[model samples]
Target: MLSGVSHTLRGLLDDLQAAANLRPGQMVVVGASSSEVQGQRIGTATSLAVGEAIVDTVLAWATELGLTVAFQCCEHLNRALVVSRSTAVARNLEEVSAVPVPGAGGAVAATAYFRLEDACLVRAVQADAGIDIGDTFIGMHLKPVVVPVRGRTRELGAAHVTMARTRPPLIGGARAVYDVETARQRLQGV
Candidate 1:
């Protein structure tokens, strides 16, 4: 089970990195259902062991890559997110008062909350990328102009996985220019 979770996470990262060029200080939000990972309906059979495996792996990988990681709570908690205090401060996110538990907040969020250094609950975040495991629905936390990435690892344990990475939204109608080189030239007073 542990190995499966780790492999799935690695696969998700590979797909995300391929699509989004993540850099230092970027944020990645994840929403997971341990029950679904165990082949049960979401919120019905949450498992701390599975949650710990996923959370630990995510935190370690994100930290090593110099990225911020956020874990989204289940509908039981109104889909609030668990993030590091530094992340909240840096991103100007509103911090809420709540401690996640296995049953109430869901095991994945609980494990991430307990494992994160200086963890805090936030109402929302515009994450650069996200992973939704077991249909937990993490779309609301992503930045606008989300580009979905079809990854090689589609499932983790017994759960289905979905991944996304965001980019700047394309603006302007016809006759409106949106070229990076042109923008750079304008910025230089060309």
Candidate 2:
């Protein structure tokens, strides 16, 4: 089961990266419900082992991509995220107290808290990308210009998967120049 989950996640993330053009040092937020992975209702049948598998898989993948990953806790923890201390400091996220447990933070977050090199909880983050397993609702952590990424492999175990990546929001009206060359030409005309 662990191997299967890891493999599925790897494929999904690969597709996301390909479509999103994610770069190094960017962060990805993951929200997972082990109960959903097991075909159970959310918060009904948490599985620590499944959570461990997910955290391990995601961390390994992120390492290979030179990206950061954060695991979001359940609503019980106010949806706070589990991230590395370095990430928290670098992103200027406010540190919060409280260690995640299976009962409160859910299995995935608890596993990430223990697995991360220097795990800490943060109130919020504007992640570059997101992967939601079991309908965990990871939208809150993503940047404003969220774009959904669809891949061939949809489900992870019994859970539904949703992925997204963000881009800088497009501002200004139709007349606003979006390219450097266009802007330069317009300025010269002026």
Candidate 3:
């Protein structure tokens, strides 16, 4: 049975995946504050149950989408991320030495660390997309050219949720043509 928070998060993640057109193996960074989810000040209260719901829900969606998920620790850990060993190896991310505890690393990250197989901490990552629950600020983990995704489900429990996807940086200036059709039309002087 899914908790209310889990159910809401599932819908939000589904909407984000569809809107962003996320592909298999793409990475999604998640930063959550279980305290905020329970309507408490961030870091003031940590709920293991809320954290479990978040980690479980996100992992289930990641499995279904064939995506890689990273959980961001709180600033107490310098915002390090918990990822699978495979993800660290595949992405060539430097491994950090530290175990996440609920009080320091944030509940969601701590839960993820235990839940993920061969879990390891990485110093940093540039993921394809990100989910920020309770304004935990996942922006730093996302790739360049971040675009906000407004999903149908706005809040997870009492926490405000924000989602984002990244696109490749647009290099050329105004004279640059984006599509073949546009290039053709410009060449024809139409």
Candidate 4:
């Protein structure tokens, strides 16, 4: 089980890098449910241990890549995001006052809150990319132009994995010709 989780996290990091061109210092929002990943209902089987393991794995990789991580809270916080205080200040996101409980923010978010340094909850953010685990719905946090990313690992345990990378909106019609190859190359981090 540990091996599987590690493999899934690696695949997710790779996909996010390749598909979103996630460079160093970029922010990525993740919405997850350990219960769903364990084949249980969304909030019914909340497990701090599972959440910590997942966060530890993912954060190790993100740290190596110099990327910032944001964990999305459950509906109890109105799906607000928990991120490092630096990220919130840099992004100019408004901080909200709230401590995440198991039932309130789900295990993953609560674990993130506990682990993060100077952690704070924000109402929203326009992240460069997003990862949705167990159908937690992170689309709203992603930038305006979202492009779907399919990783080698489709599912992480019982959770369905979905990824998205945002791009600038395409302008100019008809006579305007966009460089499709360049765009693809950019996405692949070439």
Candidate 5:
């Protein structure tokens, strides 16, 4: 189980980096459900312990890569995100009130809220990249022009994983000579 967690984390990092070209100080939104990852229904078997373990692993990796992370709450919070207050201000996001709980926000978001430094809830964020574990629907938080990312592991436990990155909208359709290398690089999982 631990090995599977590690592998999933590694693959997620690779896919995120490749898809978004996430640079230092960038924000990425994560929507997760530990229960789903542990082969349970999305919110049925919420586990703070599992959520903590996943958060610890992800935060370590994100810190090393110089990326900021925002954990998305479940539908109860209208899918609001939990992030550091600093990140909220930096990104010009609207801060909201309320702390996450397992029932209202899901265990994953609740765990993030507890772990983050000076955490705050935000109504929305135009995140540079996003990972959706168990199909929590993170598209609303991502920047425009969401491009899907296919990683080595399609599912983490029972949860299906999905990723997306934004790109500049291409105009002048037929005659446009897009940056082939950049497009290819993103598709190649860099």
Candidate 6:
């Protein structure tokens, strides 16, 4: 049987997908602290099992949608992220040298690092959407224009989950008429 946290995470993923309306090539960054999920201090307790479960669920969903998933490292590593090599190339993110481990990168990031296919540590990323679990501070990785996503489920396990999705910046503030049709057309397949 899956754990309660695992079930909660799956629901969170579904909510994110629906609310974010992410396109196939878009990205979602996740910053999770397993210790907090277990109701402990951020890095005081690391659970490989919880980390692996969350990573697996996110990867499955992202792969199904043809989307990228980035895992943010703990503050010990300056919050660099683990992203696929392709993501680094496509997003023009700087690759950093580091293999995330439990102590340095927290359980979620370390597990993601080891399990991700063709993964690399990147200096930063501007993701289309994000989830910050246990106040891990994922906002730094999201795009400039962010809209908060409030779902029926606000907490995942013992951690407080905050979600956000991004939109393209609106320009020509006053006199310009926003082209709603064009924007809808752009996201027609999402």
TM-score of each: 0.91, 0.92, 0.93, 0.90, 0.88, 0.91
Local accuracy by lDDT, each model:
0.89, 0.93, 0.92, 0.87, 0.85, 0.88
Query: Can you write out model 1's per-residue Cα lDDT over 78-140, one digit (the tens) per residue?
Result: 899999898899889999889999887899999988888899999999999988999999999
Model 5 lDDT per residue over 9-85, tens place: 77777877887788898878899888888888788898787677677777887998999999999988999999999
Candidate 4, superposed: residue stretches over 4 Å from native: 180-190
The TM-score of candidate 2 is 0.92
State the local distance difference test value for candidate 2. 0.93
C-alpha RMSD of candidate 3: 2.0
Assess candidate 5 and give its TM-score to the true structure: 0.88
Better of 1 and 2 by lDDT: 2
lDDT of 2 by residue, 24-73 (tens): 99999999999998899889999999999899888888999999998999
Error of 5 at 80 (Å): 0.7
Which digits, one per residue and each the tens of the lDDT, describe model 6 over residues 34-59? 88887888899998888988899889
Name the best candidate (by TM-score): 3
Ordered by lDDT, highest first, the candidates read: 2, 3, 1, 6, 4, 5
Model 5 lDDT-worst window of ten: 1-10
By TM-score, the better pick of 4 and 5 is: 4
Point out the higher-scoring one by lDDT: 5 or 6: 6
The superposed Cα distance between candidate 4 and the true structure at residue 155, in angstroms, equals 0.8
TM-score of 4: 0.90
